[model samples]
Target chain A: MTTEMTHTTASEPVTDRPIMTPAVDVYENQDELLIVADLPGVTSDSLSIDLEDDRLTIYGRRKALCSEDTPVLMGGGRAFDFRRVFTVPEAVDAEKITASLEAGVLQLHLPRHERTKPRRISIRTAG
Target chain B: MWMTWNDFDRHFAAIDTLRRELERSVGGTRQSRRLGRWPEATLVDEGERFVFAVDVPGLTQDDLTIDVHNSTLTVAARRVVNPPEGYATHRSERTGFEWKKSFTLPAKIDGERTAANLEEGVLTISLSKLPEAQPRRISIA
Candidate 1:
């Protein structure tokens, strides 16, 4: 069985303000890695993805839509910022990283480097 | 062997079950926040309305149901996982679940005025308070 290692090392970097770490699911295949994070209430205009020092960072803010006339009586509202960081493997093709957000979920695609792809070996019969 | 997403989900579910057992033993009768399959929810009394927000990632309006009966609000939904055919899943952490919850309104509300909307997987419900239940300022004689 081929063992696939998910996130080897994940950390929540300190933001200027405290932030919640969005729940994430990671998958990998022969060609690329997929990272999906659930960031409800976050809009595309407020989402940000960055890569620095081999660490992939995701940040987003979900704006609250309350008005002065509306007073919050109960707790547990989901209006806050999201932040998470993951260390990328050396085999990843950082230059080819791509991301998309839909319905409040963010998907990141990281392609494998050409050299890291597996290749089949051919045997030569004795001449 | 190629690992499919279904296999990965089973593995995680096993670990989650074990973890829950440990927590139950150590925490001493603490209740989990999960309501059915949905995450924790918040209920707010917005003076004129009661607002409900439930975290339901990867869900759409078609998957949810909202109803009011006898001053109680009920929300129900199911999250289904369907991976594309032919793609071998290396890992998976998201799984399908059923979410069902009901809450008793603190005060009478106008059921006819209730409204709900789903955005980014968060289901929000607004229950307008009955006119009599609203606070009224008394004028000094």
Candidate 2:
């Protein structure tokens, strides 16, 4: 049996780095895996996803765009900064990975490698 | 230099009072401001397991904490705001409210092996059924 272990690390950075906290969903089907991430206030122009080796990274920045009519009693809060990293399994077909964003949710589809697909075997009857 | 000590004390007191009032007004306004409402969540049973979906956009895992105890599940997160330099205010729609939502799970679920994932602002949590909740097959006579 092959055992799979997934580890997640969460921390707070001391430096003046941007903060990104987008929620995500993952689903596995017979042939592929699907990932969805919610990034409200982020536009497509400011979103980016990159894959290197077996790691996938998602980044997005939401610019502050409050209207002139809004009153500014006090100002504080990172406009909108988001970043997430995931380790892809070797069975994933990296070349065919695709991602798209709609209404602030980012969707990613990772197809399984050809060799790892399931195959059926026929039983033989002998006299 | 020729002014009386009483005059100096009065001037300083006036400035101090003004500063105190300014600070009080700022604090009051901030406290009175509304943070906004939380979104609704739904759970459905799909034969094999129970699936829960919550609407919580723009929240990272670091900002969120999930807890399960005695068949109750709670999700809490704080949204931080760090305005940029030279950025001015415009229209505002997104709620700056910190969220803390919870749900009571059914007894049929296996609380120990629950799994959660967040995607596209929707948080989906799955709870597998307990062995007792699963259907059993009886031997034929």
Candidate 3:
């Protein structure tokens, strides 16, 4: 599993609000790889997904629950934003990658290159 | 890191005790807090009403149940994820959780006039203040 995943935690950002590392689920099969991330309160306009070389990054900002002036009587520390970085395999076809967001969950589909797919070999009996 | 809003000195002089009750339930440090406050919520007073909001991504209204009493509000939810039929799992970091959390409001509320909405994975519950509990303005003659 170490060979498949190569990622490091974030270094630093100058801000008082906490930035959360969103939880992600990765699934793979012969055809494609699926990545799902949870980012509540983030709309499509505030969410961004970027891929450069083999590193994939996801970023989203959480909308403020309370407007200003109102004191939070009972408060829970709401995370300011959600961000995560992952190292994707080189065999993936970056051109065919697609993504969709619904109900604050993002799904990314990465299809493998045609040459990397498994092939079957057959031999005919000699008469 | 985790920043809690302590803006209590603004207009909430009556609810001064709530300032000390601020939640430090952040980071995986304490076992009691880490396990208790799932889908943490923030309750605020909005003049005539109280607003409660919580982050519940991938959840709908059908998955949640909200109840409001005199000075307490309860929320119960069940989140379940079904994997793909024939897909191989590479990394599974997201999991489902079942929890019921209750919040204490600063003032008395009208339980019969509560409204709840679930939008874009955020659950917002609005509780109206009782007629006698709301503030009233009187103009000098």
Would candidate 2 be rated incorrect, acceptable, medium or high by CAPRI criteria?
incorrect
> What local lDDT does model 2 show for residue B77?
68
Off-target runs (Cα >4 Å) in candidate 2 are A1-17, A67-77, B1-141
Q: What is the interface RMSD of each candidate, in Å?
A: 8.3, 19.5, 4.7
The prediction achieving the highest lDDT against the true structure is 3
Could you tell me which 10 consecutive residues in candidate 1 chain B have the lowest summed lDDT? B28-37
Which residues of candidate 1, in runs, are more than 4 Å off?
A1-17, A65-73, A124-127, B1-37, B82-91
Q: Considering every candidate listed, which one attains the maximal TM-score?
A: 3
- Least accurate 10 contiguous residues by lDDT in model 3 chain B: B27-36
How much lDDT does each candidate structure score?
0.68, 0.58, 0.73
Model with the higher DockQ, candidate 1 or 2: 1
Model 2's lDDT to the true fold? 0.58
**Residue pairs of candidate 1 with colliding backbone atoms:** A73-B45, A74-B44, A74-B45
- Rank the models by TM-score, top first: 3, 1, 2
Model 3 is docked with a DockQ of 0.45
- How much is B139 displaced in model 2, in angstroms? 94
Q: Give the 10-residue window scoring lowest on summed lDDT in candidate 2 chain B.
A: B28-37
